[model samples]
Target: MIVQLSDIELTARTLVMASQILVILLGFTIVYIAFQGYRRNRSRPMLFIAVGFTLIIGVQAISAGVYVVFDVSELAAGAVSQAAQLSGLICILYALRMEG
Candidate 1:
């Protein structure tokens, strides 16, 4: 048997790239806000957001890179997906906690 990058895989790759980009952007925003808060002598909750977002983005990028460079094994794909999801969930929880 042989495996190749199908249309679905391509679409998934694109989605992952877009998601990572968004996460990075959000991380940047968090860092910027944190800096501003520091200058203003306010609570720097944005730092936590930045850390969470960074973790999510980093994990996602790693997963996407592995998917692109390695063989498309089911186990590898599943692990990447799970890592991305868990990181994303953690980021969301952190964001919500900060906002609340």
Candidate 2:
């Protein structure tokens, strides 16, 4: 069956996709800055922070791709993305607690 989206729906989806792309770009920029901080200070905490951000954003991006490419269910994709984000948050928390 072929379904067609209304103009508003199409525009909304387009805007959402554009926003997601922008978010990915911004997220990577943050990761780059954190990695640079790690390089400058040689801090394990900073390294972990960078990794955490990467995992969070990278999994989100990948999950979107997987959803589109594999035609996976939205619930499954969301679950995978949420799990990765949870892991990433744990990394960030551990970094915060780690002693310098």
Highest-scoring model, TM-score: 2
Residue lDDT tens for model 2, 1-100: 9999999999999999899999999989989999999999999999999999998999999999999999899999999999999998999999999997
- Which sections of candidate 1 miss by over 4 Å? 1-44, 72-74, 95-100
TM-score of each: 0.47, 0.89
After aligning candidate 2 to the native by TM-score, how far in Å is the CA of 65 from where it should be?
0.3
* Number of colliding residue pairs in each model: 0, 0
Q: Which segments of candidate 2 are over 4 A away from where they belong?
A: none
Name the top lDDT candidate: 2
Model 1 local distance difference test score? 0.67
User: How does residue 71 of candidate 1 score in lDDT?
Assistant: 75
